[model samples]
Target: MRHRLYVPTAAAACLLLAIPASAAQPTPGAPGIGDSYYPTYGNGGYDVSHYDLRLKYQPEDDGLEGTATITATAKQDLSRFNLDFALDVDSVLVGGKKAGFAKTGDHELEITPSSALASGRSFTVVVRYRGTPSAVEASGFTGWLRTPDGGVAANEPESAWWWFPSNDHPLDKATYDVSVAVPDGTQAISNGTLQSSSSKLGWTRYNWRSSKPQATYLATLAVGRFDITTDTTADGLPVINAYSKDLGANDGAARASVERSIEVADWLGEVFGPYPFDALGGYVPNVPTGYALETQTRPFYSPRQFANGSNVSVVVHELAHQWYGDSVSLKDWRDIWVNEGFARYAQWLWSEKEGEGTAQELADYVYSQHPADDPFWTVKPGDPGPENQFHGAVYDRGAVALQALRNEVGDKDFFAILKQWPTQHRYGNASVADFRKFAEQVSGKRLTELFDTWLFTPSKPSALSARQAAVGTVKAPERPRSWKKIRATDSVHAHRH
Candidate 1:
C-alpha cells in the first residue's frame, strides 16, 4: 500500500513568519548547519566561491606547509565566521590585512575580519600553516593516508580539514586552484585540468585548476613517484592517468583500466547526457586505503581493488559518480545515499548494457542476499547514522529505491529522470527532499510512498509489490515530456559565474 502526501503551497510562507524582523547588530554566524549525523559539519551564514590552495610538501619526512585563500560572500550580517581546519595555523589574514584568529572547538577556525563584513559583501581569508598532516579516523577508515613513497589526500566526508581549510561541507561548492611544490623527483596531482609545472631549486611545482565547481571533499591530491600517461579521448578531451611506481607487475592492468575509463566516459555521456567535466582520467596509487573514491575528474583506485584483473565494473561505478556524486553533490551528509545509490544503479545499468544481466536481476540478487533482519536494513538509507554513512543500506537499498521508482514510472520516464536530475542540478547541492520534489515534478506521479519505503523506513522494500500498488492506484498528471540533451555548446559550467 502506498501512502499519499499533501504538500501545502504556503509552507515556506508559514516558516518565514516565525523569523522575527529586526535591525539587529552584526553577530557571529552559526558554527554548523545542525546536521543530525555530523552536527558541526558545515558552517552557517556565508557561501564560498573559490579556494586558492598553495601547499609545499616534503615527502622525506612527510612535512607539509600550506596557505588556503578562500573567497566567499556573506549571506547575512556577520561579525565573525568559521572555516573547518584541523591543521596547525601559524597566521591568518582577512582581505589582505592581518586578522585575529584562534582555533576553536573541533575543526573550527574562528576568524574576526579586520572589519565587519556586511550582508552580500565579498571577502577573502588566508591562513598559513605548517604541520605533518594527520587523517580523520572514522568508520574504521582514515580520510588521508601516507604511502611508502608519498601521500594521497582523499578527503571524503569531512577530511579536507586535515589537509587544508575551507567550507568543508558539500553544499558550499567552489572552484579550486591547487598548486603544490614537491621534491624534484616526486610528482603532485590534484583535481581539474593541468595548468603548469616548473622545476627549479630542487623543487617541482605542479599547478592544477578546477574551473568547474567542486565540493571540497572531491578535491584531491596524489603525491608520489608516478608513471604518468597522457592522451586524448576521441573527442580530443585530455586524459592523464597516473600509476604508482610501486605497482610493479600490476602496472599493465592498472594502465588498461585507465584507458578503459575513456571508453566508459563516452558510453555514459550518451546514456546519462553529456559528461559533466572538462576531462576524464584516474589514478591507481598503492595507498593502504581499502576503497576507491570518485574524486571529481580523476577517480582514485587502490591497487588491491584490481587484484583479480582490470575491474571495469569498478571503473564504470566511479566514472558514473563523476556525473552523480562529483557533479551533483549532496546537500547534507545524511543524504549520502544520493551519491552511493545513484552510482550503484549506474553500475547495474552498465551491466545490463553489456549483456551481463538486467538491472532487475541484479536488484533481486542484492535484495535476496540479505535477510530482512540484517543491519543493512536496520540503518535507513537516506538518514543513516554518522558512523554508518557507507552502510550497505545506502548502496544496495538506495539502488533499490531508484529501481522501484523506475518500475512505478516506465522506462522512458525513468531514464529521463536520470538525465534531467544531474542536468538541472549540475555542480550544485541537493537533498533527498529536493530529489523527491524533483521526481514528483518530472514523473507527474506521487512518489511519497516509494521514497518512504526504500529510504526512510527500516524494513526491506518489496519493490514489485509497492510499485505495482503505486502504478495501479495513482494517476500521474499529464505534462509535456521532452528529453533535452545539454551538450558543451548548450550549457556553461557553473564555476564561470
Candidate 2:
C-alpha cells in the first residue's frame, strides 16, 4: 500500500515561518477546532498527516499501553497544542525533544513543545500512554467495546480519545500505521490491509497499514480471536472479512451479510463511481451494540445487526459510506445528513436492486408513518442540532428528501449528482450547503424551495410543492421490517432518535 507521507525538512520548516522580529510572540493553539455544535471536538493550529500507533494490549485486565507518533503540519506559529486523549501519559516528545505536558480537561493533553513550531512547518508529537480504553468514559458512554476475550476500539464522533492521543474529529483526517502486540493466540485487526504479524516471547505483534487518509473516529483497533477470510472481487480488489469466534447463533447470518461487502461495493460503484479505498472488507466484533460504523476501508459491525438473519441492507448502508462518509467526510457534524442520509438512500437503492422496494416506495412509507403532528418532522435533517444528530429523521426522512430531489431534478441529473459528488470532493470534507450547491450546479435547476422544505425547515413539509407532490402519492406498501430494525442501529444515540 502507498501513502502520501509528510517528511519535514529544515529548509521547509524555516520557509514556513513568517515571524517578524519586531512583533513576534508565540501563542498557544486553540483548544477547539471551531466546530459549532461540539465546540471543543478537535484542536486547531495543526493538521495531522499520519498516525503511527504502536500498542500493547492484555485482554485479561483490558489494559492497553501504547506510544502514538503523530505527524502533523502547523497551520500557524504555535507554542503549544492539544491532543484529545483520556489515558495517563508517561511522557511526551515533540520533534524528538521532551515537552512539558499536562491533562487540562477530560480528554485534552496540552503539550508545550520544546520550541515553537513555525506556520506550515511539519512536526511530530510522540505520546506514550497507558489506559483501559473500555473503562474510559465521557458523557456516560464508552467508545471501546470490551468483549469476553478482548476489546475493540470503534465508535462515532469519538473513540481515539480512549485509545490514542489525536486531533479526534472527522475534520482532520490522516493515514494510520497501527502495530499491536497481544497474546500469541489472539489476533489484532485494524483499518486497511494487514501488513504483517510476528510472535516473540509469548507476545504476537500485528502490523496494519491504512494508505488512505481516514477520520480519527473511523480508525479502529480490535484485539481478539477471529475467523479471518481473504478473497478478491472479480476486478481483483482485495477483500478481507473477520468474524469473532464466539458469535454463536449470529455467526452464520453475520458472515452471510458481511461477506457480500465486495458484491455490494461493486454495485454501489456503478451508482456512486469507483470505490475510494484500496482494501474492501468488514469486521464483526461479537459486540452487542446496535451500530455499524464505516471505519475507513474496514467497517466495524455489531453482532446485533445480523441477529434477525442476513441483513444485507445494513451491509449496503455501511459500505456505501466508504464513498459518502469515509472518502467524502463532513465539514461539520451538523451535516451528518451528508453521511447518514446518503447511506440510508443507498440501502434503498439496494432494496430496489434486490426487488424488495424502490426508493420511492420506501420514502413514501417513511413519510406516511410520520404524520403532520409527529415530532419527527420537526427535526431538520440538514442542520440537525447536536442533540438530534443521529435521529431517525436524519436517516429516514433525509433519504426521503433525496427521493424528492431525484423526482424534482429527474434521474439523469440526480444520479449524476450522486456519482459526481464523491469525485468532486474525494478525500476531503464537505457540508450540506456544499451538497445543495453541488446538486443545483449539476442539475442546472433552481431548487431553493425544495431544499428548504426537506432539509432546513423544521415542520412537516406540508406545502403542496413539486418536491412534496413527487412523493405524496399514497401507494406505500407495508414498511420493511429490516428498515424498522435500522431505526435501532444508531448506537451513538439510538435511544434519543
How many steric overlaps are in each model, in order? 0, 0
Query: Which lDDT tens digits does candidate 2 get at residues 1-497?
Result: 99999976988878656555524576788998989788888999999999999999999999999999999999888989999998899999999999999998688899999889988899999999998887777667788888988999887788888899999888999999999999999999899888899999999999999998899989998889999999988887788899999999999999998998888999999999999888999999877777788888888888888887888878888898999999999999998999999998998888777777778877767877877999998999999899889888898889989998998889999999999999999999999999999999999998888889998899987733364566665554588644654554555235221
Candidate 2 wrong stretches, greater than 4 Å: 1-23, 463-497
How much does candidate 1 score in TM-score? Answer: 0.87
How close is each model in CA RMSD to the real structure?
A: 10.2, 7.6
Off by over 4 Å in 1: 1-23, 135-142, 462-497
lDDT value, residue 105 of candidate 2: 68
lDDT of each: 0.79, 0.87
